[model samples]
Each structure stands twice: as structure tokens, then as C-alpha cells.
Target: MERRLKISSGERLLDRALDEGIALEQECGGKLACASCRVVVLQGMHHLVAASEDEVDMLERAGASAPNARLACQVRGTGDIVIEIPDAELPPACAASSPVRVTPRAARHLAAQLNKHAGAVAVRLAVERSGCSGFSYRIDPAGAIGDGDAVFESHGVRIAVDAASLPYVQGTLLDLVREGLAHRLQIDNPNVRESCGCGKSFSARSS
Candidate 1:
């Protein structure tokens, strides 16, 4: 079925489709690393940039059926377009199964940071629009829990997650791990569908 999906100059096809509530399967998180997000362009091929060399390679490997077949992840929207997901399977409704988990390492790190910053009260978790993926995680010092906020104590530190941000980070594990000489908070989120090459942003859908 052809649907009118408005594609901005830089938005990806999958992201915009989701924005319009048209769910499409994208198991690889729109990383351009999987075939689950393939679609056949029904019109507006010229509106899209020609497939990248790597994209062409991936498509070739998948034995994609047509000249108009393209990876939704690699295709940036330049104008309104028509495309079809040939597979008949219905897209699943994505939702978080539970709140994020705080690992011992992460809780310890949060405690230490909270101690060091005497003015701080707790760690606030937020999800912001970022990266090639639609969102990125943000952590900050929250003096007091906001309305509809999920606040609790884990390990030795207080953690707060607003209702809106809670779902995106659901079933995630936050931990502090050593990456060389520096320490980093590792976000082990199951909902993450794809992350940008630089790791600055990621795209995720609910499960």
C-alpha cells in the first residue's frame, strides 16, 4: 500500500514512518547493517540520494529483488515519497517491559559522584532526541523529583526517572566500566535498535 510519508531533508525513512505511526520492522536499529528494514521504492527515487557503495554491497548480498529496493536506514528523505514493505508480517507494537536497572558498578559510581558533588541530590535519567538514532540517554543531578517522576533509592544513591523517559530506557542496565584509564557508564538497553557510527546517538523502538 502506498502511503504519503513526509520525509524531511535529513530524516530517515524509518524514523519518519514511526513518527507518523506507521510501524515498520527494523531489527538492526536502522544501522544499515541488516535486511529487516528493506523497502521497495514505488516512487520518488530521484528524491533520494543514490545508494551508498556500502549500501549497494549490502543490498547485493541480500539479493534484493529490484532496482528500486533500498535500505530504509541508508535512505535519507529529501521529499514526500512512496515505498512498500513487501513482507506481509505486521509490525509489532513496541513498549517497554520494565524500568531500567541500576547495576552495582553504576550505583557505586553514582554514589561517588553524588558524594563529590555535595550540592547534588540524585541522578536524573532522561532521553533526548539525538544521533542518527532517534534518541540518546542523558543523566544529570536532580535536586528534587518532578511530578510523575519515578524516584527511588538503589545501592546508596537516589535515582529519578520521569514518566516520559522511563519507557525508552526500560529494561536497561546502567553500569560503570573501565574503558582504558577512564571510567564510563555503560548503558545496556535492550530497546536500542541502532546506534550511530559515532555512538553519539541511537535509534530505538519499543519491544
Candidate 2:
């Protein structure tokens, strides 16, 4: 059985759970050295703040790279969010043979997005625990440089990424393709060893 916890602004999900007298695991003393406090975010993603580099590293090692998987200790701020603490162990790393890339058109498209959002710096790319393949990307507009984030620029367009997302998207080739009068981003990732039939997520090719 799972229980919901109430939290306020500036409060962390894990802290609220502990303060509410819930028995939660903390194998690494909440230092993010161990991936013991993994949680599957059910809803309210925009309201929840982004995770840090260390937290992303821990979660990636645990193979919880879906769009919804987040370390409890890394979750910040208070929002009406739903999450499930899972009983699991840290998994292995995803190794890629190359680096991430983007097409000229995709770069231009991304730049357009940055221009649309006033003061936006770039686009942030991260992996979330999602899809049948156990992993997916969570991309969004970036307003500033984040802690431990890798910034990539091409054709004057920038895309920020966390260390955890490196292996999964290293060999990725991003393009902005036009489909039936609609333009959308397309990703041709070589690190994907397997993907679900629906094509919403992917699994890393173990090296």
C-alpha cells in the first residue's frame, strides 16, 4: 500500500514523508550515493522542480530513466503531486559509442523556440522513467544554466543535458521533420537497443 503526503513550498518530497512519520528507505543517508529512494511521479510534473545532476546520475544507474522516475531526495518544492516509492536496486550504466548530434533544421527550430520564450537560454534534455522500454526523454525550455548540466550549441541553437542523459542520447540525431502540414522533432538515436512497439520509449544497448 502507498500513502500520500502533504507538503508546502520549499519542502522536499522525502522530507515531508519523513516528517509525516512514514517509514521510507534511505540507504545512502539521502546523499544520492545509493538509489534507494526511487519514486515514480504520477502527475504534476510542471509543478515539481527539476532534479539535480547527482540525482539524475543515481536514477540513471538504477535504470529508472523514464520521464517519471525521480529520486525522492532530489524532488523539491511543494505541489499537488503524486508519486510511488518503489522497492528496487540500482542498476547498471548505459554506454554509447558516440556523441549526440542535431540537424541544421532542428537547430533552427530549437532556436525559434528559444526566441519565442523571452529570455530563454536553451532547451534542457533529460531522461524520465517512462514507456514500455523503461526510458524516455523529458525536454523543455531552459532559461539558465543548471548545476552540472552540459550545454550544446549548433547553428546558434543550444540544448542542455544532464550527465544521466548522455549515454542514452549520445548517438542521437535530432531533426525537425514536417508531417502532413505539421512540423515535429524527430530523434534518430543509435543508443536505443530496443524500443516498444508504440515507439514512445527505448532501452539502452548494454555494452
Taking all chains together, each candidate's TM-score versus the true structure is 0.51, 0.51
Off by over 4 Å in 2: 1-97
| Highest lDDT scorer | 1
Candidate 2 lDDT for residue 147: 89
| TM-score for candidate 1, residues paired by index | 0.51
Q: Count the backbone clashes (under 3 Å) in each candidate.
A: 6, 8
> How does model 2 score by TM-score?
0.51
**Model 2 steric clash pairs:** 65-128, 65-129, 66-128, 66-129, 66-130, 67-128, 67-129, 99-170
lDDT of predicted model 2: 0.72
